[model samples]
Target: MDTRIRRGRRALVNWLERLHRLAPAKSVVWVPAGTFALILVLWIGTISRIQAEGREARQAAAGATSQVASSFAAHIDKTVHDADVAVRWIKYEYERSPSTFRLDTYKEKGLISAGTALQVTIVGPDGEVLQTTTPEAQPVNVSDRRHFLAHKSSPDIGLYISRPVLGRVSHHWTLQFTRRLNNPDGSFAGVVVVSEDPDFLTTGFNNLEALGVGGMLVVMSDNGYLLSRLASGEHASPVGPPASAYREMVDAKGEGFTDPVDRVPRIVTYRHSTQYPVAVLAGISEKVALAGYRHARDLYILMAGLLTVVLLAAAAIITATMTRLVAARARMQHLAETDALTGLPNRYLLTEILRRRIGRERPLDRLALLFVDLDNFKRINDALGHQTGDELLQNVARRLVRVAGNKSFVARVGGDEFVLVVEGMDVAVAARDMARSIIDTFELAFGLRGNSYVMRVSIGVAVYTAESETEYDLLRQADLAMYAAKEEGRSANASRYHTFAPDLAVRGMRDIERQQELQYAIQNNEFFLEYQPIVSLDTGDTLGVEALVRWRHPEKGIVLPGEFIPFAESTGFIIPIGELILEAACAQFSEWMESDPRPLYLSVNVSAAQLVHGDLIGVIRQCLERHSIDPRRLKLEITETAILKDAALIARRLKELRLLGVRVVLDDFGTGYSSLAHLTNLMVDGVKIDRSFTRGVPGDRTALAMFQSIVSLTHDLGLSLVVEGVETEQQVNWLRRFGHIEVQGFYFCRPVAPGSLQAGRAA
Candidate 1:
């Protein structure tokens, strides 16, 4: 058994040595035990001290409660004695002047108080006639009254206190004090009565400190009839004292007792009125009476609790310090090699892995590095907040890890860029599979904080070769390939990817220069607008002209919008470009309207950037005011793309435009990643079928049928239609079948300069 115990001890020691690398093997066992022992001692000592102080406070509270209860009972007894004396004086007054019994004379003589005595009355021998101090009193026979009958039957019944009742004349709950009146022959002739307002008697006691909030003073008959009680400021009852009250109160006399009254335990003091058959009960609610001592006890408890918290906080600080001291080197190493945000291998570790693999790996250990870049991540970060950006990056890292699996070394290089290194003769295929998995993962929406977001990843793939300069060159090539994928995505909304090549880097440089030149072009006003006339396919009559934006670079000559518009939109430069175009078109069209009122309307395209950021309505109104043009002749053409992204905002702005009488058109009718519901919902004046749909026209039955359907729907919905990209006469003649549908493309006339447009009108 002792050998087995030795083996167990050895096993524990080995386990501790393996787990705790910093601590020496011998001392690991005692350090934690010492800390625990110290904490336990502190806790026990703190509790002991608090309990001692609590006991002292309790004793003081009990003594104080007894003192307060005793004082309140004394006050009640004194009040009742005073009222008894007043009643006795009234009895004396009635005896002195039997025929003319008046409380006014007694009140003047200072023998009675109006505040305490509610009424004073006298009844004749046959209980037939009465006189009272109250005003407007009729004669009331007291033949059946207990107080009166008690006096009349037993001539020596002294000052008799009756049960509480509503006085007929006084009209308040009163306790009647009755005394017998005898003729000279010793026969009972009448009864003299004094009524006391029980509420008035208890009013002064209510204000006393002993009977504070939730305390009460009660006046009760010896037999348990409750005359009155005061518990207004307190939450206790005033209907009567509790059932057990009579035993404690009647027996207590001037002393107080601690007992529950009305199910609420209280420290009660009571006394019987010496001159009357009544008892005065004064009580302090046990809950309220112990408030002072309870507060002290609570303070002690709180102090002990604070001490315990302080002890715990100190222990935690020390423990944390010790833990960090033990793990400092390991944590420092981890931070140096790992990405802190997503816990992936950072650039430093990736470099190390590449260096080791290149130096030691076999010739057939081919490698591929995938550089993943999330598209539009920065826009989402800026718009939603950094928290969402962080969650997105973390989620992106997780997806890369999952797709890269165990064989690939997936490392987060930095901000939305991750490098995946894979090995095998077929590593390129593996890299492609990983990239596809990442793209597929991004297709599924990410739900966060009650919002769903779709993220797209642009991956650049580079395979290892003997010609490669170094591992850094591989990452750089991967980076260039990633940018190429992003460039490919610029033309479409979906995610795109590319493999590294020699010429890709050169194109990337050109794209960079182009972006720079685009910004410069905006500042230098190298942009101009051309108007393309929209002619009716049926008669070749010009209905309206669509304003098209063109940029004239000095070296590159005229550049089309498809080359720079996406970049402008991406960088938010489209807003300013759209503004410049609208301002110029509105000015030029207003001039054309004055010279030639040939039923011409001008359409200007509105970008998503302009609709969301710039105030389209305000700019158009300003343009109309400056040009003095009829708003009906001006059209703001917005593509269907903006509807799916910001439908609510665009819909509201378009409704405002419709109200302003500016004709609106939904441009690029079928190409947008939008729904038909958007077309129905928007308040537009016209729809321009995009040029792509027109390419399959004239002979393609599907194309003709679709156009015919669109024409019918457009006319039914009260919107005019325009067919674009019509280059042949046969296509135009066939399209003419749809009545009054406007056609605009290179077929009718290419986008011409404003001067050329005026010249064509002259011809």
Candidate 2:
């Protein structure tokens, strides 16, 4: 026997065993048969009647849906034909007698007509009312409407219907139809607009009969504004633009078929006017459309109840008809096939569907399997407890059913993860915007146990096309897409079934290796120091040495700070690197001070990261005390641009460092954010003139003048200046001639080890 048959037999046996346990053998066997047979007969009759009613209900809903659709088409046909007639008549009269059919003449001739509470107005291209049949001469602008623009820009115009809008001129509802007016030379002279009240079209919406018990009829704009509804209660109060519920549907454009306006299942349909861009929507309640299905469902429930009674009676009759051993075996089989929760189809049933879908050779239409994972679901389970999380999942499942409607199938694959299979839709519809809408749906602040928490969903969409030849391939792509979404910061990301790019994979590997290398560098004391001597131009004496950092790599030897410093900064490892440089510089300075106590300062270049970090000052204080070095022997060199940011704060911080006897020098003085105004705003010991100006001064006249001016300004501001990159006697002389500027370059000596420096003046 098949598994389902065995399970059914086991379920019957289990019912018999329970009955035997409750009552004596004679009563259990005799009494239940009599009771169950009568109940079964009545239930069978009830189900037959219910099914007939269901079939009738379904027929009625289909007829009603068809009726509403037909009425809308009729309304569009009538409105466009009437508008075409009115606009063309005005054009004909104007062409016949341009002078006689002028504004006042047309009104006197009764050329314009009025209907009910609606009026018609004909305006020229310049916005002047040429003729009017309205109670008041309403000033109107036709330039903004597409109908008017179509007439204004083109000559081929009879009539054009514009999108519905709140008429600015009338302060009442109106639809505009424009007719083009042309000069004898075929140039656009003006346009004639016929304005009609909206009731001319809304009458169709007002007349739609009820589709079912819970049915409703509504007419809305392409932009989702509710123009009118057929429901009796003050439709106007809530009858305006669509709210959050219809937002996604409207954005999707025409024929946005979805479900449930405030949990009342609905069918939404839209049609765009062939004559114009205007859109009309018709919404029918799902309760009404599926009212027939409810009757079928009610009949099924009755059948189940009747079957339960019949089984009880049969079991009583067969109290010992089947052997005790067979009854026990059957009961065990039934338990294995059923799910404990939800009582819906199990994994086994789902596999059967997948197998059948894949076996067919027919061209499968576009199908998408979206694997949705709840964000922060684990956090909710951990914080609020699992019971609340379980309830939240159930609610999410219900919402998915509402959103997916009958167009898609949804299943709970595992904890907090749901699978949605939407068929016969374009794959692009499952992309980012739709994913965002799904997330927004869950973000509506879920209420649980008197506490509200926010929830979000990340969907990984896998579309089955000709590329996906197998079911496994489709499932794998969706799983990979889910992982991609999580890795890329987890709101939603979609991936297709393709190999990961080599370049991106290589980059990820390199990052991991680099992190490990950085960790090793930090652990081992591999960092060392190098000092470059700064020589005085006027006196030709060694002034100071700027401390530079070098790394003694395990494999590669002597790595420059420039090579590794950027990596360190990007990886946020610069804090430790800066500390190493500061400590080493201060200790080296202390040793040099003992040999030459005559206050020759040591300048250390500081990166922007080192200066901006909050703990830098404290690190500096700790290093100074540890080295037992005089603070005055240290001069901090920073760029002009670095100081320009929050100058007031930097100045205050620099003042404190200066008070501790440390000198501050501005490096790259001319390269960035350099201005005389900054010199006054910031308190610095000296400025290191950038090398560009010095390197070009001899060859370029502009460079020479700028260099000369900078030198003069440094003295005027009462600040000392260092001219860097001086390589020859001539360059040194040119810098000296500028007066009081100190120079440091190859003219004196190249940067050397601290011990290589000779303090004596040049002969």
Which has the greatest lDDT?
A: 1
Candidate 2, residues 92-153, lDDT tens digits: the string is 77766667775445555665555422445566767566665654665666566666677777
TM-score against native, each model: 0.45, 0.37
lDDT against the true structure, each candidate: 0.73, 0.63
Question: Lowest summed lDDT over 10 consecutive residues: which window, candidate 1?
Answer: 1-10
What TM-score does candidate 1 reach? 0.45
Error of 2 at 515 (Å): 3.6
Residue runs of model 1 more than 4 Å from their true location after superposition: 1-369, 374-393, 402-456, 463-476, 483-497, 536-542, 562-573, 597-599, 612-622, 625-631, 641-661, 671-678, 691-700, 726-738, 745-749, 759-763
Off by over 4 Å in 2: 1-501, 641-652, 673-677
lDDT of 1: 0.73
TM-score: model 2 vs. ground truth? 0.37
Worst lDDT run of 10 residues, candidate 2, spans 493-502
